[model samples]
Target: MGFRLPGTRRASFATKVASSKSCEVPKGYLAVYVGEKMKRFVIPISYLNQSSFQELLSQVEEEYGYDHPMGALTIPCREDVFLNVTSSFNRC
Candidate 1:
């Protein structure tokens, strides 16, 4: 059987560019784009404790090899995530 996903969550799954090379956005995550054309994307993380979250961010930076993929990063929801606003580096 084939499984299909919804539109709004397009970025949630892997994508293949015009090159035909398939690329996955990494499981358990979704990227938020910046600017009108959706140029850049940044990861989101929940759980307050600002300090701890920052630490987690540091780790993500190390793994992603880029400090703040975009000019902003957001952690949607406090206890339960919904959507990350990363456009301004804070919740939307």
Candidate 2:
């Protein structure tokens, strides 16, 4: 089954945060699309508190301004860079 990334249909973040496994976000994590193809990654919620990760969120906010077609938080960055940041978070 394809992982269901949030889309632009509506503001689902609040709903996703409240629901359980059936909501596609799993638990304590979120799905984001990275790279040109919009690749998807389900990342831990703790990553939100990291400065490096927050940088990416800022970029997303700047570009999308809470509205885009991808349904998921889109990170406009090289896959390697995204992976490197996330890998460090995994280590912590």
Candidate 3:
């Protein structure tokens, strides 16, 4: 069975981007933009502590350096790859 580390919590990012209203991501979660379409995904803050996720953050730093225009962490990777990584992360 999957278990979460201490203080780790999962948050849902609804995939419905077609809505006129945007959903508010909770305080403990961060919004990341993924793929060519720049789809947004809200994830738990705990993922930042993972080494693999840190690699992605490195890329984000190189690209935007905390100056992300969208006010979200924009990841420069395919959506599938990001999803695959998060899927594995969820199990941890």
Candidate 4:
């Protein structure tokens, strides 16, 4: 089975994008913006502890310091690469 975050609820992509308000992250999750289009994804806060994810955070820090123009955590990578990295977490 795929690894699912404890409090995650499966939402259709369109529903997720449409339903998610600009600042409405749930209690156990945080929102991140990714890719050139700045698509938003709500992910478990636990991901912050993953080394690979931390590396991505580091990249963001280097590129944007403490001032993210999007006013949220923004990952500076292609959507496919971000998906590949996070998907690997499911296999562990």
In terms of lDDT, the poorest run of 10 residues in model 1 is 79-88
The sequence of per-residue lDDT tens digits that candidate 4 reaches over residues 14-86 is 2464247667777777778888988778777778888999998888788878776888888878877877676
* Model 3 pairs in collision: none
In model 3, the runs with Cα more than 4 Å from the true position are: 1-23
RMSD of each: 12.7, 9.9, 5.3, 3.8
User: How well is each residue in 14-86 modelled by candidate 3, as lDDT tens digits?
Assistant: 3332121466776787677877888777677888898888888887788768876667777878887887666
Each model's lDDT comes to 0.35, 0.65, 0.66, 0.70
TM-score of 4: 0.74
Give the higher-TM-score candidate: 1 or 4. 4
What lDDT tens digits, residue by residue, belong to model 2 across residues 18-84?
Answer: 3334437767787777788776677667789989899888987987687757776778787778877
User: Taking the tens digit of each residue's C-alpha lDDT, what string does model 1 give over 13-73?
Assistant: 3222211223334454444433334332323333233464566456546655454544445
Best by TM-score: 4
Estimate TM-scores for all models: 0.23, 0.65, 0.68, 0.74
Q: Model 3 compared with the native: what TM-score?
A: 0.68
Residue 10 C-alpha lDDT in model 2? 35
Which stretches of model 4 miss by more than 4 angstroms? 1-22
Off by over 4 Å in 2: 1-23
